[model samples]
Target: MKYLGIILSAIGLMIIINSCSKSWTDYSALQVQNLNQDSNTALNNKTYQTYLANLRSYKSSKHSIVMGWIEWGDKTSTANSTLNDLPDSLDFISILNPSNTLSDEKKQDLSSVQKNKGTKVLYNLNLQNWDDSLYSTFNKIGYLLNVDSAFQSQLDSVILAINSLGYDGVDVNVEGMNCSSCGSFFYTYQTGYYNRILDTLGKLYGPHSNTEKFLLVEGATTASLLSGTESYFNYYIANTNDYSWYYQVDNAYATIAQIPGFTNDKLIITTDFNDKSVSADISDKLWQYGGIPFYTNGSGTPIPSSTALLNWNPTSGLKGGMGIFYINYDYFNNDFTITKNIIKTLNPSGE
Candidate 1:
C-alpha cells in the first residue's frame, strides 16, 4: 500500500511538469501566407459593417491615418466638397498629375499650378516621352522609368521650382525601362544631378535652415526590379501587381522578401476602389502579411468615403488603408451613404 501511494504521487508530479513545459514552448510566431494565390472567401456585407461599428465602439486610442491622391486637372467641385467636409482625423493628401482626368476647360483652373507655388505637393510624372514642354513651371513631377537629357533638364527645372515655390522634397516613381538605361534616371535622382538640383534649390529655398529631401521609388513587386539589391531606392514601393496592395495572398511572403530593404513608412501597396468585393478571409490574410491598403481615387475627383473603404466589423474592419483611385471621383463618392457607413463603422473617429 505504501509503495503504491509513493508511485501515484510521482506520476501526478510528472504530469504537471509536462503540462508546464508544453505551454512555454508554444511561443512560435504567426504563420503568414501569399495574397495573390489565396482563394478569396466572400465577405458578408453586414458583418463588415458590424466590424466597422465595433472598431468605432471600441474607440481604440490609435487614430486612423487617411491619405488621398488629388490629380491636377480633376473636377474640383466634388473633391472640394469632400475636402471641405473631410473629418479632422484625416492626415495628408498627395497631389499627383493634375491632368490625370481633368477636362480642357476645368484643367485651366491653375489652382493646382498655384498649389505648386505654395505648399509641399507630391508629383507623379510618367515619362513615356522626353518632351519637357508638356509640363508646367509650378508642378512637382516624379519621372517614370525612361531617361534622357530632356527628362534631366525637366527634373532640374522641377528642383528650381521647388525652391521658387518654397516646398518640401521629392519622390521618384520610375518603371518600364531597361536595366542598362536606368543609370541616368538613377543619377539624376539618387543624389547626382538630382541632388545638385535639390542642393541648389535648398540654398535658395532655405537660407535659414537645412532642407531635407526624401528619395521615393515605386515598383510592382521585388521582381519588378531584377537588377538585384544594387538597384533599390528609398521610400516608395509601387506594387502594381498586388491585388489588395497590402494583404497580398499571392506570393505575399515572397514579394515582401524581394524588396532589399522594406520599412513600413517606405512601402505603399496598391489596392483598388472596388476591393470591397474581395473576401474577408483574403483581407485578413493581407493584414497578417503586413500589406498596407492603397486606392487611386479615380480621375481628378475627391475620393468618395464609401468606395475608398468598405464594410467594417470588430475582428476585421478597415477595408482599405490609403486611397489612390484612378484620377476619378466617381468611384469614391458614388455611394456616399455606403461609404460613410463603411468609414464610420471602421473608423468612428471620422464620425
Candidate 2:
C-alpha cells in the first residue's frame, strides 16, 4: 500500500480546500442569469419559428441538445462518420475517448478530426483502472500531465498538436480500474489536472480559452461509496460544487428525485435510454427536478432529431436537460443527418 500515503495526503489536502471554500458559491445567481440569457437569445433566432412549428408537432416544453460520440481509433474512412454526418446546424459533438486504447500511431491520426465541424468537442482521455501499475503510471502521467515541468513540456507538445489539428476541448475520462488506498490520489490527481488545464488553456487561447472545456468522468457518484473516498468529494467538490457534475444514472428518475438538490442545477442526470419513447418518459420526470437530463443512445445508433422540439407541457415544465447519446461509425448515414437536422430545426444557437 505504498500508494496509500499518496492517496491519503491527496484527500487530506482536498478536505482542507473544501471546508474553507463551501459558502462562497452563488448557484442561484448564475441560474437566473443563464435562464434570462437563454430565454432572450431564443427570441432572436431565425429558427425560432421553425422551432415553434416543430413544437406544435409535439407537446413538450423540454429543451435539450443531441450529441454523438466519435471514437478515436475508428478507421479513417469511417472515423468521421459522426462528424461528417452531423447536421450543419447541430449544437455540439462530443469526441469520446479519442485514444482510449489506441496505439501511438492511431492516436496521432486523430489530430484534426473535428476541425471543420464547428461543433464543441468533449475530448476524452480515460485512464484504464487505478491499480498499482496504473497509479504508478498515472503518477508519472500526473507529473507528465499536471506536475513535472520537464515531462509536461513533452505532453504539452502533443496536446498543442491536438489543438492545432482540431480538438475543441478535453474530456478527462479516468474510470473503472482499481487504485487501492490511492483513491485519494485519484481525486487529487484529477482536480490538479483540471486546474492545470484551465490555467494553461487560459494562457494559450486567451479570449478563445478552452476554459469553457468540459470534463467527464464516468463514475463521479460511485467514488463516494468507497471507504475513504467521501473526502475526495470534500476537496474537489468545493471547486466543482457550483458547476454541473453529471451523474450517469439510468432509470434512476424516481430514484434520483429523493436526493434533494441532486435534481437542481448542480447535477446533470444522464441515462441510457435505447430510443425516443423511453427517453421522453425519463425526461418527463427529470424536468420537475429542475435538473438537466442526458440520454444515451447505444453505439452506432442515433436518436430521432425531432426530439429537440417535442411539445412538452408537463403542468410542471418541459424537461430542461441536455441530450447525450452514444454513437459510432456503424450508426453513421443520412438517417443520422435527418436526426441532427431535427435537433437543429428545434434548438438553434441563439436559442
Candidate 3:
C-alpha cells in the first residue's frame, strides 16, 4: 500500500508538469502569431490625400508652386524680405526657424505676410537634434513610442500659432532620426513617433490642407526607415545641388518611389538657385523626372530664362511646374530678379 501511494503521487506530479508545459507552448504560439499579423499591417492605414496633388498645377493656380525658406537663427534680419516683398507668383514659404519663439520684428513680418499676401505660410519646425534640455520628447524615443499620448498634443500649439497667424499649414523637418549611439531601436521608436504625429496632423488637417512635411529624414533613408512613411505626407521639398542636380534629383525621387505608396509626381526638387548653370533647358530636365524644379536664391547669378522655355511644351516630358525661393539673400538680394525672370518665363502672359 505504501509503494502504490508513492507511485500515485509521482504520476500526479508528472501530469501537473505536462499541463503547465502545454499551456506555455500554446501561449507562445499565440504571441508569435499576433506579432506576425501586426508586422504585415501598414504603419499608416489612412489613404494618401490627393486633393492638392498635381505639382504641375499646384494650388489650382495654374503655375507651379515656388517654395522659399525664411530660415531663422542667422543673425541677418529678414525685415526687408517681408510678405509684401514676395511676388504674386510665390506659392509656399516655410518659416524654417528652430522654435516658435520669434523676435518682435519676425512676428511683425510673419503677421503682415499672412494677413496681406495670401501666400501659404507653412510653419517649419526643426526636431533634428536631441538636446537634453529641450524637446524632451526626442530624448527617450523608446519610452515615448509606448506612451505617445503624453506629448501628442504638443504639436497642436504650433498649429494653433499657425491658425492665430492665419497661415496655411505646418511643415515639419526632422533630423537625427538615425542615432547611431541609440542603435536600430532608436530608428524603430522614432519611426513610431513620426507615425503617431502624422496620424495626429492628418486628423488636424482633415481632408483639405497639406497636413505635414514630417518625413524629410536627415539621418536614415533606408527602405526600413522611409518606405511607408511617405504616405503620410503629400508634398515634400527635396534639396539638391548645382553640380549634380540632375542625378541627385533622380536618386532622391527613386528612393521616394520605393515607398510603394509614393509616385514620381509627389516630389518637388527645391534646388539652390545660386547655381549659374541653370540654363533655359533645365526645365526640360526637371520635366523629364515628372517633378517641378523650384529654385530658391542662394548665391551666384541664376541663368536667365528665355522665351524658348515659355513656349517649349513637351508631350514626352512630364511637366511639374517650377518656382523660386523668398525675395532675399545677401548674394541674391531681396528684389529676386532671377526668380522673377523664371516666373515670367513660366507665365509669359503675366509679363
TM-score of each: 0.41, 0.40, 0.56
Tell me how far the alpha carbon of residue 286 in candidate 3 is from the true structure, in angstroms, after superposition. 21
* Clash count of each predicted structure: 49, 14, 0
Q: CA lDDT of 211 in candidate 2?
A: 53
- Choose the strongest candidate by lDDT: 3
- The runs of at least 3 residues in candidate 1 whose Cα sits more than 4 Å from the true structure, single-residue gaps closed, are 1-65, 74-90, 98-120, 127-148, 166-168, 178-215, 220-234, 240-253, 256-260, 272-321, 327-351
* Candidate 2 accuracy as TM-score: 0.40
Give candidate 2's whole-model lDDT: 0.34
Off by over 4 Å in 2: 1-63, 73-82, 99-117, 127-134, 137-158, 174-325, 329-334, 337-351
Q: Lowest summed-lDDT stretch of 10 residues in model 3?
A: 1-10
Give the C-alpha miss distance for residue 87 in model 2, angstroms.
Answer: 4.0
Could you give candidate 3's per-residue lDDT for residues 29-130 as a string of tens digits? 112212112434221211101101221133344444455665543223432245434443455676655365666655655554343333566776554433
Indicate the residue-level lDDT of 299 in model 2.
41
Candidate 2: Cα lDDT at 150: 35
Candidate 1 C-alpha lDDT tens digits along 1-351:
111011111221222223222210111010001111121321123332232233333322343333334444433334332222222122333445422233443323333222211212344443323223422221234444333355557766666654443334443444443334444434344323333333343343322234443333444353443243322333444433334322333344345445655433334434333323334534532222222233433333323223332321113232223334332232344322232333344444332
Q: In candidate 2, how many Å is residue 135 off?
A: 2.7
